[model samples]
Target: MPIKSLLILISLLLFTQNIAAKEYKWSNKLTFLGFLKKHGIPQKTYYKMHKEDKELIQEIRAGQSYSINRKKGKITTINIPVSDELMLQLKNSKKGYTYKYVEIPYDLIERTISIKMKYGFKKDLYRATKTWYYGKELEEVYSKSIPFNKMRKGDRIILFYTQRYRNNKPYTSPQIDACLIEIKGKPFYGFLMDNEKYYDSLGRQYKRTYTTRFIRPVPNMKRISSRFTHRRYHPIHKRYRPHLGIDYAARSGSRIVASSKGKVVFKGWKGGYGRTIEIQHANGLKTLYAHMRGYAKGVNRGTYVGQGKTIGYVGTSGRSTGPHLHFGLYKKGRAINPARYVSKPSAKTIKLKGKAYNKLRKLVRHYRPQFRETRARKNSIIKKESKKCLNCFKKLPPRKK
Candidate 1:
């Protein structure tokens, strides 16, 4: 071929590439619906896309970029990224624009991290894992058996986790596959049995049985603003009175869960309790949640709710100073301390035997050696640090205590 002909062919290829690479950005002030209008997308086509894929409308956000391919000054194709793993593509055809959802593949990467606590468990866990969310995951896994707040100075933790990655960048939060926490030389192991549940080495579920009568109504809340007592100063009443229930300080709209599986005997407004929900469980055990902003949708009187279902949202509905959940526990018809029920371990535990227990044991053994080594190293470091601190203190001028 002649040199002139080759140059003309290269110019044509470059021009085609530029046309295909035309990209547009959605403005921050415009909603997704308005964005389509600004871009000349027809209302009928937008409605058709929404009818076919509701998520396309639900997941759109401002400032997102989309590619637009034009043919003779008419847009032919639009590709919008819905999420890291999903894309919404619309193409112009004789019939109009047609939409299709495209899924992007990602790699699931397994990771292991071991760390000794110099600070709190959350801080140390975050430092070792380099992920902020792993601390919460660890706490949730061990909340049933371990007290994370009570973990001592020399406690060590080993976590085997998995995360999804796209192009070697994290695309999802880390999930705990298995974890071992050693508090004061005692090891507690938690293995992921399934989605939303964990088990011990013996294949016992971390959650209590329904027959246990009571579980934590709000396991995620760490602080109790008020405790059940015969006499206490009322925050609003300005007088001494009996506080019938415990007040769990939580953010407004935070989920208030049912303590046990039972029927919703009452779910409506109460005088000072604001929005109240009461569940009647087996064996005459009853639990109450008060000071809720509103009841969870579909949760009403006569409805049976599961142990961990969201019953209401935290709020200062009536006669309350701030947002908090007033939790009450009852036996037969008498009010009791809700803390007692949660502080005590469940009397009944699901014991796995034979093949089931062995399977869990094998899975735990895979991480045991790693945990042991990590714990040993942590102890050595703590010992050295302690000695160094003692020497430094001795060298300083003594002050009156």
Candidate 2:
């Protein structure tokens, strides 16, 4: 009787496994082609990808997690995130293996993490949360203005951030909205603005001394078909989605020029992007032009091109619904709004003023009340060893202008 029961338990476990999606970590040494081959996916499935789509597979980093659902040990579906907003999905049917780029479905979770310095900011943060992602970001925001060497014991630290979650776990690093650091007894505050820059209580920026302004790739902007956003309700899918790049609606065969001086890194068909070109410019900047008709002569990979030089022609390509160009700008592998970088090159530090500064003031006001509440708490009452936060961010109703 005991032996029969054990066999039944093993069978039940196997049956449950077949219906559930199993998660796996991507190996560093495994190329995208190698991954397909190892899983019995046909080599042609990889070779047939648009050269641009082929380049996108490189964005899959080692240790990145993916999911697979199988039946009888045969893959039925697979989802692998290739970029922050896009995923590579593979489905197996009776005919063959098929793949496409889809939006990576995730939830946005807003949180606040508070800690007191015991073993330094990074170490103490890791101790409380089991992660150390916000250290570099905090340093980048305050390193120039604050003296890190002066941090003393019990220096309070608080951050209000939002992160993307998949499978109920963190999918990416926290995007800090506001941060407060106490040096000695005085408090320093940093608030995030829509421009993706952090400013102090007075709307001053202290990180970089100079800013490199960028130009629009397409000449004569008729209109923007789609704008960049971190979150929005999709009209077709009825889901909250993020668009990392902007789309410019233009006529077919219109001239597309290089946004700035840079060397051509890639020029080929990308999955949904259709015909695409990527250029590597100075200051760790990279620009992308997609959904084009054709490339300019001699603008191959590794060729240096200057700003305003013709690089490609616009057309409907990839998974486009119409004749529009998808333009993307990235800094160190992170997508940022190209709209902010245009026509604002300056040699001196850029400070928030006028309407931009007023917008930042609103953001600061939203976060100030929380700071006041936190200031009342005694350091002895704070959970120095535990990974807990003070309170989540709250938005007050906007006042009439």
Candidate 3:
């Protein structure tokens, strides 16, 4: 009886040990995403941060433990490390997403930029944040939303893109990105879950083209000031002051055309710049006319001038510069070389330039060869069809009356 009792006690102990040893292990067998949902954590936050990373999408292994730490109902951290050439690190619930939008400035040194939001984070990703670029006053740039999906680890972006001028001047601005993540097994590089957030934030089109104004800028015309003799070293100053403005050689009092259509912001003497006119063009562009013998009739400050219209004439009035028209081009408030904007003066010139750049030569060469090949193929097909019809003795029926 005692032996029987001992055997029963051992059996009970073994049963208890078996139940207790059932280890709770998570696997890559279940979707790493599915596990998060089953555990009752938010998937939206995770999805927002890594949606754009194609490599990360490929490396997710089922049955692999996704190390995460939670506080209350929110995910504080996620560490599923993958290794690749581009080092990508993901961080959960770091700081709220932030951004500032800025408009192009007016002046030549600095542009007129406006901010939408100050630096702050919202609880929800749907909220918009704004900021501005201030040269003198605010210019109203748009706000940006937190990119939940496109916001990946090690992701970077620019708030504003500096436009190129004819002279190819360089401008500097800040580039910002999210912090890097460190997962255990492999380092998933270039992973941004929903990073397309900032780019798509303003609902602004990714692709852009000029459509509103009819008058576009021209490019590559000879400037008389760029002549070699004018570049001679000054004797008194004992230093070389390269000619600042480009001179277009023309007859005295010739019809000086407006480079682009814009309101005349200033039309008067600008120091040594004699009888000058400045026209404000669209998209932060401006043009200057200097050394004019006389102003064009009906041309004045605040007047809307059309492109190619006679705004003034040539003269050597300001500082003995020369009898050439001094032309200037300004973009984002900075002076650029004028040669970049000289397009054709008429439709005929435009067509000629297009023909030079287009496939007219290649098309001419290919036309005869392509026509011959097509004719041969057509003849072969006709011969085959005729032979087949004759063999079948398929004749056309009489047309109905």
Candidate 4:
């Protein structure tokens, strides 16, 4: 009885295999000689193709696969293969005119991946393989393990994915088994085959690339005015005043913050820039805050302000302007646009916080002391990696405005 059952199972498997391997059938009949007469495929093409591949013409029979090129409603050429002996016979026979095989185009698909960044971090589902370019050949590139965070905005990345075509048509579903993110600063890259192995665009692969960088929070963050441009003739003045600062048009009394850990070098009134405050940051870089309504209590000429600490409120105290904060940056005593240095907070800030907070809340609801160990582990990892950041690269001295 066991032997009989095994035999039945093996037969069923073989039947299934045969069904899967079945060749596709043409939905309708297509002409070979008629197609050639209409397409004007040169006789040399068939002769050359058959001479090199003798079995090509003979093997092409009714219901067999072949390509036809048509112009208007006429067939100009036909290609058929003949075996070596048959080829000679056909050449000699008066009934056989001349024949040639034209090159048949093979289908190829190109896939594009777009990683959208919001203030330089992953915010939404990074799009993969949204558009495809179809051609006879596909361009592909790959790089060995590369760090992700090293990639900056507008950096070009050539990712790789595998595809197969059948009967000169692209398969609707593609196997996107891997991708390679290449950038000049990245350290490593590799394929992500299985779901378990896949990482987000800025996952652990980028952690090391962003070393020594901490989240520099903007205190009472406000919108920025005046984008950096070469032809920046002043918006208000109309004449070129060499706009050194990025205007943040905010309501009066909006808080102004220290960009980094720094000490106030110059405070109080200065020519043209009414209530100006200059904070000399570490490494010889300085941040100048102009047009302040009032200064924070205890923030004076020598006061030390921590990174992101509010030091004053936005106001129009300078050179006759409406309520706004004229934020300026000077390094090595030359002005540069402050807009280039600032970025909005990333989605990771909210996502990481949400994950930890939700987990903690769940533990609290259950009143489980066992969850304490999980919390401790999470905190330990955060503490170890907290100080390491992506922006810790030494600042280059500012260029003249």
Off by over 4 Å in 3: 1-223, 227-242, 343-401
Distance (Å) between predicted and true CA of 119, model 3?
24
Go through the candidates in order and give the clash count of each. Answer: 0, 4, 52, 33
Q: In candidate 4, where is summed lDDT lowest over 10 consecutive residues?
A: 134-143
lDDT of 3 by residue, 83-184 (tens): 111112334445732111111111112111111122211111112212233211110111111222333332221121222221244322211111111122
Task: Write model 1 residue lDDT over 254-287, tens digit each, in one string.
Answer: 8899988999998876545657898998867888
Model number with the top TM-score: 2
Model 4 TM: 0.34
Measured with C-alpha atoms, the lDDT of residue 141 in candidate 4 is 13
Error of 1 at 340 (Å): 23
Sort every candidate by lDDT, greatest first.
Answer: 2, 1, 4, 3
Better of 1 and 3 by TM-score: 1
Candidate 4 residues lying further than 4 Å off, grouped into runs, are: 1-218, 229-231, 234-239, 344-401
Which candidate, 1 or 2, would have the higher lDDT against the true structure?
2
Q: In model 3, what is the error at residue 268, expressed in angstroms?
A: 1.3
Note the residue pairs that clash in candidate 1: none
Best by lDDT: 2
Return the lDDT, model 1, position 311: 88
lDDT of 1 at 110: 64
Per-model TM-score on C-alpha atoms: 0.48, 0.60, 0.33, 0.34
